[model samples]
Target chain A: MGRPLINTLRIALHLLIIRPLLRLLFGVNVVGRENLDGVDRFIMAANHNSHLDIFLLLSALPPGKTAKTHPVAARDYFEKPAWLFGIVQFLLRPIWVDRNNSGLAAIKEMQRRLDDGCSIIIFPEGTRGQAGELQDFRGGVGLIARQNPDIPVVPVYLEGPERAFPKDAAFPLPLWNHITIGPPQLIRGKSREITSALYRHLKTLADEEQAYRQRRQPEPHRPFVAAVIGIDGSGKSTLSRRVIGCFKGESCFVGDGLELFTNGEPHDAQPLTINEVRKWMGRQAKSAKNLARYKMRKLAELLLRDRLLSEVERWYRPDHIFMDGSPLLNMTAWAMLFHEEFFNAEVCSKALDILSGKDDRLKKDPIFEQFPELKALRKLNLNHLHLPDAVIFLDVDPEVSMQRIASRGEAVQAHENTEKLTKLRAAYHLVCDVLEQSRPVCRLSGDKSLEQLTQEAAAFIKKVGSGVDETD
Target chain B: MLDAEPSIYSLIVLVLLSVAQAVSLVSKGRLATPASLPVLWGLFLALAVSEWISFIAALWILAIISFCALREYLSLVDIRLEDRWGILFSYFSIPFMFYLIQIDWYGFFIVAIPVYAFLLMPVCVALGGRSRGIVFSVGALDFGLFFYVSCMGHLCYLAFFSERIAMLMIATVAAADLIHRALRNRPRALRVPLQVVVACVLFTGLAEWSAIPLNHSFALGIIIPLLVCLGRFTLKQIEDDLGIRADRLQPGRGRTIDALKSYLFIAPIVFHYLRWFLKWGAL
Candidate 1:
């Protein structure tokens, strides 16, 4: 009835009703909570992975503050039983509106609540991601947020909810899931403009989740078989196809499946640029202890080779076939997760064994050294995936690369504050510099258009593919 | 009607008291919560309840009411602080002149507040160094105070002059208040049509019996509802010109359209003419 009373009831409902359920079932883990800040109004535009997403979000909230905040719930489910609905409205005070309807009423109600300085949590995906895959998102949250530009919209990823409540099931199953909240990004502008903004926000959250998953997996001592790196908007696909085109042998698209280690349809598997890899590498320390041990894991080779073994039976493992974006670039940079001295000789021997993979010819190719700082490059002479005769590094500025990617029509998320798309572009440029100086690392100028550059690079690759006589 | 021997002291006191009331009003700004029309009617009833003191009390408070009503009019019109003295004489003083008649001072009171105050205010404002065609200041405030003090003052004089005066004022006041209420929120269903019929019959009967002449005035009252309806643009006009809508012009109450028109058009003119005629005959 009154502000204080409503606040008290909200706290009680969360403590007595919601928290216990989350602890009992999901054993919910919340991460990156230091990023949370109190603000007047905003939508928590989280990736909806499970029925557990609601509870996961509840757990992520600092105690007692959910009083003024509401998670938007679909009316069809949250309003079914009168008694349950009363309890939910009493505790959560969720802004329940008909999901089947055009969401105009909910938008109006949300606008009213926002005017009163209230916050709402919106699941941007609008439904659960099935089979551990991030689904394409809907744009209602975008529209409402666009209508009210002052509201900050935060992206939250609730990983592992389908395991808890799979689709078409009446009840939930027991499982553990982590709730990851990305930093808040506000939605501004109208209609298509806002929807594009929401789409970009969702992609960033998905990227953060992918990066988080990569850090959590066990480290292997396997050699760096392949490393794919590119800037935020750089056309990594064309470069990837050209590099793969060089090797006159069977090739399969390894993409990010090897990176994520999940057996599902891969979405947006572009190569990680230097800075993007560094960003992921920056997160590795949070992933585990003995960071050296974590870096050496053969997760990529095993996943890639296995996919090749099982899915592409027609092609035998070629003597020295080139792969595209397979071995994510910048291992020596990722090794920075452990301090420099720790990347020593014994580490190289273990890494070499992993790289050679029990093949004699694969062990003999010259190690590619892209940067002087990368100590592991000295040891990479021992190749795991039949070391390439040479390593070709396409040196593209992140800005040009990003522009190129935009030209290719990929839905890349633009950084919120910058008008010139400089932040993401700058990130791309940093990666290009890191990949600039390696052994046999041919630096291809990346400023040209994707087609022209791809054709020129293809010709260069063909020349290199045939062994030139020492006299000529 | 012009007399030179009244010491002009009477003129000065009426002028000074009107000025003081203006200063008090300008300092008070607009009413935060408007006094309800019912409360205003009750105040009028207090004046009417006693015959001997009624005229004296009405005259005593008439300057205050004119001050108040004109203050409401100026605020509703958004007159500036610099113009208060001019408004006091031009707008409020005219009403006080009529109020002076309760004590048998009529010759100077009849013309000075309305005619001379109207001519002098704009010149005084122009002398003070700002001119924005603020004739509306003189006009609106003049209209407001004249109706309350001059016209209503004459209406009050009728009762003291003749026994018929008391009954007529009571009937007019009661009828006006009732008509406002009936138009605002008539009882649900067909009662509205029935109430309208009764209002029409009662109003027609009362108009014919009243001592004041009303051919042009009552005819204007008849067309007022049509004007108010057509004057839907008044809301925009008020906002454009005055920066505030007049009380009855705000965008609500379709049924009360007729009632507001009557309050705005008829009541003031009838009362003023009555008070003037009663004093003219030395009743």
Candidate 2:
């Protein structure tokens, strides 16, 4: 009972205090946590650099695993008579080894610990390096590893700790550090050959970590908004789903047609029927009065959707928000459907005026005076809906879009035909030209495979979100 | 007394050269190949330190250069485990050679590596009682020490001359290299003569500007270009015999052998001229 209580207290302190403190001080990042999965009994050999290396490595372990892990610290340093040593022993539970004496007893102790199902952390370097470089591995680690051939040895690369705390410095400087864990390697042959192999493995891991760090910059903290716009059957929904799948963590999707945006999830929203779309598109504006009313009603519906989305944004502030289709795309589509030439500044202005409820044409009609709710939406200012952080316009050939829509085995809308899609594709390009004046717009070929489109979309989103292009 | 301060003119020339190299590299959209930056940095340090510090500090820099060159040579060739001690001892002899230059003990510096280092390496390897390829190992170590240490040691001996004269000789070698690189793809008949002509013109002009005598300048004009050609040919032969490309010394970079060969070839010429100027006044 007494031993269990002490172990419990030590784990609690490590998880609650020590781990958070190390992360805060060093900004430590661990790259390969998956390699340690299901690995219970193994020796972790790392390059020794600073006093902080052991702590940084320990912090990377999953909670509750620390109780079964032990670090092989030097007897001369950790066994000294001091309060710090006592705390270290209780918290870290290090196994002490004498460097000057023969390592026979230490090897036996390590084997015994491994037999008891406890993993040990050993620095093959045996001592801290001089200038943060990986030094030659001592033969003692190989001897121990060779004795227990069944127990695998995992090589780890500890970077930036020497710069943080050099051998002669009294205190550490605040610097970013990283811990890269490699796959477990089995020891083979004599001690010298094993040591050489382990040294080469550690050097390769360090070089790979250096390249990875250079390629991956810090992600931004501000919330980003991106939208996918394309003609019908241009793989907008598929591309959006794949792009969202790329983000491993928190992201939210908002807008119409949520049913089409399922990234392997069960579709919840009802799919629009062909009859409803045909009825809307076939209701040709017999006169100027009917066309004006139709435009006002569509504009009011877009504004109301924008108002609801703003409420969702306030309720849940996620890292990213992916809209299936924005109000600007819908407005452009409506203009192309009703007017002869939709790719004009006059149409753009008219769409904006109607959405803002500032158009004199809307007030002159009875449809606007009957709905006071539409007038209230005017104060909401749907201008934010027009601008996104990035726009991914998937440009597909009209014949390909028609073939894809036909193959989906669903009710196809009137606009899904090749003739209409060609015009819609042109209007989408015009929309991109206008939107890109204020935001970043990436054009991707939709005729390619699904995997290729997803990769291109994800790359564009990451580039835009990082704020790398100042022109945006 | 020698001017204790570094020559402002030499510093200005080095700065301008660095800026031009930087602009050219940037315009080409290529990085200063790994070997190019280090060679330029080493030359700048040698010139700057010889002008600012006393002769001893400059000799220490040459000692460091010899150590690095020996390291480069060993890395390129294979040495047995038992022969490591002999190779290490050869590396240790570099500082002693520079120390001889420091004390102005020219006689010992000349013989330290050729006689002592050459004899000591074979004995150390023989002490291990391994006779297989013993001759080859001893020969490789002796040649490395002789070429990288003893031959390069002559550059330290040249520090006794006026800084202006030393800088001018180094610049002449650099001019020869530029001419060689610019005309590398031309016919041998056209390339070799043009290299010599450009090198002679640059050397003569710089020597006259530094107030060197006309005869001495003319002799240097003839000797420096010939040495440059010989050094290039020797390095080419070594590369061919070893089946190693020059760029393999540093990946993602052009060949560094040209700069190294220039340093090796200019050392003896500068040393001879220093001896003449000090012992018999200007030639």
Per-residue lDDT tens digits for candidate 2, residues A1-472, read 5998998898888888888877654456676878889887888999888898888888877776788889988888766678878988887788778878988888888888889999999998888877547888888888888888888899989876765565765556444466888998888888788889999999998776444221112233445778888887887776787788886445666644332223334333433343244234334321224445656555655555455445445544456667766665666555665564424754554444555344645545433343333344544544344456789998989998888888988666545578778877877887777667667999998768889889888988887887743543
TM-score of chain A considered alone, across all candidate predictions:
0.43, 0.44
DockQ each: 0.00, 0.01
DockQ of 1: 0.00
Winning model by lDDT: 2
Which runs in model 1 stand beyond 4 Å of their true positions? A1-7, A168-174, A211-472, B1-283
lDDT tens digits, residue span B187-241, model 2: 7688667767776676677764555676677677777877878887887766554
List model 1 lDDT by residue over B37-113, tens digit each.
Answer: 32234334434433324456555554444444443344334343345456545444634565566566656656655
lDDT per residue as tens, model 1, A1-472? 5988877766886787778876653456666676676755667877776566776787777774566678888888867689988877776777877877888888888888888877788876676656456666676776787777777777777665654555654455333455767777765677567667766766776675444121212322121222333433445555655555444443433443222111222223333343244335434432435424444443333334433422222233222333443332333223323343444433443343344353344333332232232334335432343333344455556556556656856444322123333433333233334333332344556677667766665565556444432312
Highest-TM-score candidate: 2
Any runs in candidate 2 off by more than 4 Å, and if so which?
A1-472, B1-7, B17-30, B240-244, B251-258, B273-283
Clash counts for all predictions: 29, 0
